[model samples]
Target: MKEYKYTINGTKYEVAVGDIEENIVTVTVNGEEYKVEMEKEAEPEKKKPVLGKPAAAAASTSDEPATNKAAVNKNNAVKAPLPGVITDIKVAVGDEVQVGDTIVVLEAMKMANNLQAEKAGKVTAVCVKIGESVMEDDALVVIE
Candidate 1:
C-alpha cells in the first residue's frame, strides 16, 4: 500500500491507496472507504529567475513620499471583525452607502453574519469576492 497526504482548505488527511482498475481508484482515509477517479497531473509552473538587483529596495527609496501618502489614504479602510467566508457582497464600487448599510454577509461557524457599514461614504473598493475566506481584521472594503 502506498500512502499519500491530501490537503483541502488547510486541513490535511492521510490516505492509503488500495486498488486501481480502469479509471476508478479505491482508497482508505482514516478508516473510511473512498472511491476516486484518476486524473492527469497538471504541468509544473515555470519560474522566472531574477538576475539583477531586487526591485523592492530601489522602488522604496524612489517613492517614499508617494508610499506615505498612500498609507495615509488607507486609514479609512473597513476591515472584517472575524474570520469567515464572505458569502455575499451587497454594494459595488462608486455606490453611495449610508451608515448601517449591509456591506457584506460573512458566514462563520455555520451562521450568516451581516457586516454593516460604520460610516456614510462611497464604496471605493470591495476587497473580497463571494466564497473568499478572510481572517480577523482583514480589509474587506475601502470606503471614501
Candidate 2:
C-alpha cells in the first residue's frame, strides 16, 4: 500500500492506495469511505524537435523568468477558501464576470457553498473542474 496526502481547500486527508491489480482504491476522507478507480499509468510521449527562427525566439523568451512574472501579473488568481469537492463551475474561460458572480460551487461538510468573484473582470483561466477536489488556497480561477 502507498500513502497519499490529498488536500481540498485547506483541509488535508491521508489516503492509502491498495489493490492496484483489481483497479480498486479505498479512500477515507473526513471519516467517510470512498471507492476510487485505479487507472494504469501511461508512458510519456516523445518530444519533437522544433526547427526555425520562430522556435528559437520562443525558446529564448521561455528561458527568461520575466515572462513568468508577466504571466502571473496579468491575472488576479482566485484561491479556494477551504478544502472541498467542486460541485459546479459557473464561469468559463473568456467569460466576462462581475463581482459577486458565482464562479464555482463547492461541497464541504455536506453543505454546498458558492464561491463568488471578488472583483469584476474577464475570466482568463479555470484551474479546477467539476467533481474535482480542491485544497485551501489552490488557484480556482484567474480574472483579468
Candidate 3:
C-alpha cells in the first residue's frame, strides 16, 4: 500500500492505494474506501533509438591479424569510450594536444563527458562531427 497527500483549491486530501490487481485497484480517499477500475493499462514512455555499430561488428574486428590492427592503430586514433553522440569537437586537424587535454565532448546516457587525449600529438584527422553518433572503440580523432 502507498499513501499520498495532495492539496487542491486549499483543501487537503489523503489518498491510499492498495491491492492493485490487473485493471482493478482498491483505493481510499479521505476516509472513504472504493474499488477503482482503470480504463486501460498505461503505456510505457518511449525510449530514444540507439544508433551505432552492432556488437557483432565490434567483435569481428578482434579476429583480424594483430599486425593489421597495429598498423591501423599506429596513428594514435582516439576512440570513443562508449556509444554516444559527438556533442562537440574541442580540437581540429593540425591542432596540438597533450596528454589529458580535452579532445571531444560526448553525450551518453543523458550526460556530457569530456573525452581527453591519451597521448601528446598533433591532430591529423577528425573522424566525427558534432551530432554524429559513434560506437565504442570507434575512432573519433587520429593524431600522429
Please give each candidate's TM-score: 0.50, 0.49, 0.50
What TM-score, to 2 decimals, does candidate 3 have?
A: 0.50
Candidate 1 clash pair list: none
Query: What is candidate 1's CA lDDT for residue 96?
Result: 94
- How many collisions per candidate? 0, 10, 0
Number of the top-ranking candidate, with lDDT as the measure: 3
lDDT, candidates in the order shown: 0.75, 0.72, 0.79
Model 3 worst lDDT run, 10 consecutive residues: 62-71
Q: Which has the better TM-score: candidate 2, or candidate 3?
A: 3
Q: Every model's Cα RMSD, please?
A: 14.7, 18.3, 9.0
How would you encode candidate 2's per-residue C-alpha lDDT over 35-71 as one tens digit per residue? 8887877779884432233533453444343334345
Location of the lowest summed lDDT over 10 successive residues in candidate 2 = 47-56
Which residue ranges in model 1 land beyond 4 Å of their true spot? 1-73
Of candidates 2 and 1, the better by lDDT: 1
For candidate 3, lDDT tens digit of each residue in 9-108? 9999999999988889999999899999989966899966434335324534554323344445534798999999877778877899999999988999
